[model samples]
Target: MKFTCEKSILQEGISTAQKAVTGKSTMPILNGILIKAKNNEITLIGSDIDLSIETKIKAEIIEEGNIVIDARLFGEIIRKLPNDVVSINTIENNSIEILCQKSRFTLIHMNGEDFPLLPSINENMIFSVPQRILRNMIKSTIFATAQDETRPILTGVLFEINNNNLNLVALDGYRLAVRSENLSTDNVISAVIPGKTLSEVSKILEEDDENVNITFTPNHILFNLGYTKIISRLLEGEFIRYNSIIPEEYNLKVIAKRGDLLHCIERASLMAKDGNTNLIKLSMEEENMIITSNSQLGMVREELNIILQGQSLQIAFNSKYLIDVLKIMEEEEIVMEFSSSVSPCVIRNKEINNCTYLVLPVRLLNS
Candidate 1:
């Protein structure tokens, strides 16, 4: 394969595709990028069987051919080269030549035929949402996905579509984050997409109103973004029946300034961090909420004025869990509903129901 293109264009395509490269020593072909030159376009693809990212860039195709080159080495070379037109050509002995402003290099290229074929989804279940909306949905819930591999299904976020609403649900054993958005689709679809794959797609998605078309298959999910597309295998197995776990009603409801509560817990967690459990207690009274933490080194006590309703109660939780939810929330004020100190605390936007976060509290020992 031979092609000449601007450095910036080539660099971006390589960088995006490189993210999907899984250099499994056992399969060297998986580490190489498949490059095809035709129709005055250069298509670059990188894949690891499970996740694949492909991008197309306009380039002058001199000799129409295809080759697979080492993703890491090719990316490093193109990135460091001068910002000028780059020319590449395949030579004898299965090697390729690279030339730029004044630099030159030659590397052995792998046979493109050996690369695994990327799964194709044709005329599948197609739906789309604004890029910004999808990006925001992923960021708000991805953090709650379980990091441990104990339950593989829990490591992926659930993409559920029912009626005209889309919900992204993620849960680690201790916390749950659910972000919802309204769309114009009436199709019901459910898929468990890996968090790692979704995170990469989020990086490539532009924060604009442009829609990203999504195609779903029984075994795969594809995110098609005009010039680029991401394909990932669906995680097998059933996800937790989340709807049954959350309480329908709470004994107490408290409305407080999100920033004020977040800051108070942050300061108190400093002391709580030193203890085995990152515990913080919230003592809610008729007119005031007291935040306190006890540790081996010291204790911290802070107070915030809150609007209380229903009843007054006290609850204890891990400071980190609350901090995660508060940091991602964009609203000025938040609503917290508590069934009891032992039950989970439900946090939601004060004025809207776009997002719901549930945090399981750490049991407090009687002293």
Candidate 2:
């Protein structure tokens, strides 16, 4: 294959496709990028069996052919090249030459025919969502996915779309997160996307209002942009019935500024981290809330003004769990609800119910 393209354009396409290349693959070809030059366009593909990414960029094609080049080496070369057009040509003896300005290098190339093919997904079961919205949805819930593989399904995010509403749900047994958004389609989709795949997809998606097309199959999901596409395998199993686990009402509710509550917990977490259990206690009095943490080395107390309703309560929780949710929240104020100290703590946006967070409190011996 022979092609000439601007360095920036080539670098972006290479970087995007390289996301799927894992160097640990047993098949050496899987660690390289499959490059196809034809029709004034250069196509780059990277895959690691379960995930694949393909991207295309316009280039001046002198000869239409295909070759596989090392993804890491090609990316580094293109990125370091001067701000000029780069030329790549297949040389004799299974090698390719790269040239830009005064720099030139030759590298061994693999036959593109040996590369695995990406799955073909039909367009029947498809939906369109804005890129920015999809990115936000992934960010809001991906953190809650289970890190351990004891239950494989919990390591993925549950995507459910029905009745013109899309919901993303994730839980790690200890905490749960749900993010919902309105849709303009009538199609229904239910699938569990691996958290690792969503994490990579979010990085490629631009924070823009432009739509990204999504197509789902029984065993795989496809994300199709105009110039790029991502294909990932779907996890096979039934997800937990999350709806039944979440409580519908609470006997105690506390409304406080998000920043104030977050800062208080963070300060208390210092002492909690010094302790064995990393526990922080909260005392909800009539008009204010007090947070305290104690360790062998020291102890700390923080007080914040809050509006409490229903009943006075005291609770304990893992400081890191609360911090995880608080750092990502985009609201000025937050609402915390509880039925009892042993019950799960529910958090929500001050104005909307579109987002929900549930953190199981650490049982205090004194409670």
Candidate 3:
């Protein structure tokens, strides 16, 4: 394959595709990025079997061919190359040569035929969504996904679309985050997308005003954004019935400034660092709310006047989980609903309208 392309554009394409390349794969070809040149375009692909990323960029094609080059080396070389135009050519001996100005480098190339085939996604059942909304949803919930591999389904984010609403749910047993938005589609479908794949997709998505088209099947999910398309394998399992976890009513409700509550919880978490249980105590007394954390190292106690109603109650929770949700909150104030000391604490952003956080309390050891 021979192509001459602008270094900046080429670098972006290589960097995006390389996100799927596995460094320690048993198959050596999986570590390489496939390059295909044809029709004045260069297509770059990288895969680790479960996830694949492909991008097509405009290039002046001198010869239409394909080859595989080491992803790591290719990325490094392209990143360090001068901003001038770059010329790439693959010879019959399976050697790829890169030239820019007076700098030249030769890399060993592998036959493209040996690379694994990526799944072909049909255009049917495809729906478009604002990239910003998708990115925000992922950012708000992906962090709560479980990192454990024991229950593979927990390691992914549950995407449910129904009745013209797009719902993104993620949980790590200890806490759960759910966000919903009104999308322009009525198609109903659900898919469990691995957290790792969503993270890689987030990186390739640029800051733009364009929308991305997403397609899903029984076994695979595809995302098409501009010239890039990402295909990821879907996890096979039933996600927890998250609706059952949400309390239908609350015994106590407290409204507080998001910033103030976030700071208080963060400071309280410092004392909880002494133990794996980052527990913080919450008590409602009259017109104020008390937040405290005690551990072997130290203790933190603070009070914030809040707009509260209903019966007074006390609860304990993992402060880290609350702080994580706080970091993603955009509203100035939030309503926190509590059912009981042992029940989950629900957080709702007033301005956001459709986002909620449910954090299961950490039982007091001495209770």
- State each model's CA lDDT, in order: 0.92, 0.93, 0.90
Cα lDDT tens digits for candidate 2, 1-367: 8889999999999999999998889999998999999999999999998899999999999999989999999889889999899999999999999999999999999999999989988977668889999999999999999999999999999999988999999999999999999987888888999999999999999999988898899999999988999999999999988989899999999999999899999999999987367799999988899999999888999999999998888899999899999987889999999999999999999997789999999997878
lDDT of 3: 0.90
How should the candidates be ordered by lDDT, best one leading? 2, 1, 3
In Å, residue 202's CA in model 1 sits off its true spot by 1.0
Instruction: Please state the error at residue 183 of candidate 3 in Å.
Output: 1.7
Q: Where is model 3 poorest over a 10-residue stretch in terms of lDDT?
A: 201-210
TM-score of 2: 0.98
Superposition TM-score, candidate 3 onto the true structure: 0.97
Q: Candidate 2 — which residues are off by over 4 angstroms?
A: none
**List of clashing residue pairs for candidate 1:** none
- What lDDT is reached at residue 345 by model 2? 93
Model 1 lDDT tens row, 53-130? 999999999999989999999999999999999999999999999999789999999988888899978945678899
